[model samples]
Target: MLKEELPPEAALDGPPPDADHVLQRTLGTVRRERHDAGRRRGRVMAATSTFMVAGALAGGVWLGQDTGDTVLRGTSAAGAHLAVQVTDTEGGLRLVATVDGVQGGEACWLVVHTKDGRTFTAGSWRANEDEVTLSGSAMVRAADVAGVSVMNHDRTPLITAG
Candidate 1:
């Protein structure tokens, strides 16, 4: 048929549509779209979890860096008074033990230890000083020993003194 010979209504309905073919194409498109959406959601979740873990690790590093050296020393006598010293290197905080009416013939020894396994031992003479100084790098902790008790009144324990 010549192009000019076709009527207007015939041109309007030029090609017959295929219903089954159209439905299949539409269903395939929907399925692909749903699959892509699921993949996008999974990626988002994985990215979020990665970010959370990284943040936690960064926070832990910051906390560890902020904490510095600590020192603990303890002195005690047989049926007498007890003395303790606690120092925080990060904050330069010092707490001296208070012992009232220490009598003669009192046996006392000061044992100092660090979280990093550094130990310092001194006799009652050193404990009599106003302040005992600890050197080297270590995390101060309470010293554990028999016949003596070390308690942390303030700050974290980095060593144990017996």
Candidate 2:
């Protein structure tokens, strides 16, 4: 331990820092930190809410959906293409069928066959264009559906698929 002496020119005592200013700065820092924390919490809540809503929508879609296919596409031996969407409606089973490559100007029919050996007509239309879309419903459940077909007005099958 070596002893050292202070210079005479050096001021031994300086004025203490202002207490009020220090207090105010400390309070301001605390308030700013608190405000930042609040903003962070708000952002977290918003993210959580968004995720929750998305999960709820996904759940609703999963729970309220139909059992049949959204789309079933097939081609006939005559080269016509058939696409169908089968859904369950309150009235019964609904079928949306799109037919393509069939000869135009012919009256065509959409039919649904049930597992119980019953056939139901869905809709009919004139094949006025290269492709046509038809929609109809039957008073049968999707579980009871056997197959679907598009036929000529004379009941000749044009396209068939299950």
Candidate 3:
């Protein structure tokens, strides 16, 4: 080891210089760091929780949505194509349909058949163009539906779904 000599002005004092201010500044810096760390942790936790809630809500909606399909397709006597999909709703069976090759100003009717041999006129529409899409509900159960038919205004069966 080597020894060095100190000048007269560099002699040690009774106590360390500025010790009080140094200790206070150090403690203040540590407190600020801790506070910032806590805030960051809180933000991370909040974000995670929000994502979890959103994910759970989305998952629930997806699980509760309808997944079954009861759809039938057929060609009409007048060279029209028809598709009818039935779904169970609160009041009855909901019908969603698409009909193509409809003549302008042609009146059409939807005929619903039940397993118990009951028939119902579910809905009707007047086609104004070549293609028509329609939706309606009827007092029939989807499970009890046996067939759906699209008929003309004269009661002629245009399309039949069996």
Candidate 4:
């Protein structure tokens, strides 16, 4: 017959009278650990939210500034001249355009193209004379505008600016 060895502490008659107390202590430890984990999670979430808000504020401020870059300026083969200043605005690209040399009673269009393959109609006007001088504004993203072009109502390209 083989004999088994036992520790001195295992010489109890049966289960300890304090068994329930030990179980309660273990449960209390688990609960405290869970509470600590929840607090940590809440702190992490608050920090992330703060960072997001700061980033949003910074982006808003940046978008409100004027970039001051000229996107296009040229004279068409048919004698239509255009000058444009592109700026980044809160809404989008702010295009201030000046046009000259368009014939009177002719419909002209300003087209803006973006780097992301998007096109926008900025404005339109009717030239009153061959020496017509006019100014207009449009909204778009200065960073996204790849080029600008002036076209007639018949879709003929008058001038293109890059």
Whole-model Cα lDDT of every candidate shown, in order: 0.45, 0.83, 0.83, 0.75
TM-score of each: 0.33, 0.58, 0.60, 0.52
- Which portions of model 4 show Cα errors greater than 4 Å? 1-67, 130-139
Pick the winner on TM-score between candidates 1 and 4. 4
Candidate 3, residue 11: Cα displacement in angstroms equals 45
Q: Write the per-residue lDDT of candidate 3 for residues 1-162, one digit (tens) a residue.
A: 222564333446533454567666787899999999999999999999999999999999998988686998888666888899888888888898888877878788989889999988988998766678888778988999888888889987878886
lDDT of 4 by residue, 1-162 (tens): 222475332546743555566666887899999999999999999999999999999999998987576657888887777788886767876677777777778788888878887778888888765544444445666767788887889977788777
Q: After superposition, how far is residue 114 of candidate 1 from its true place, in Å?
A: 30
Candidate 3 stretches with Cα past 4 Å from truth are 1-55, 58-66
Candidate 1 per-residue lDDT, tens place, 17-110, comes to 5336665578789999999999999999999999999999999999888444223333444332444555455533333444433343333334
Error of 1 at 97 (Å): 9.5
Model 3 residue 29 lDDT? 100
- The C-alpha stretches of model 2 lying farther than 4 A from their native spots are 1-70
Considering only N, C-alpha and C atoms within 3 Å, which residue pairs clash in candidate 2?
Answer: none
Give the C-alpha lDDT of model 1: 0.45
Q: List candidate 1 segments past 4 Å from native.
A: 1-18, 68-162
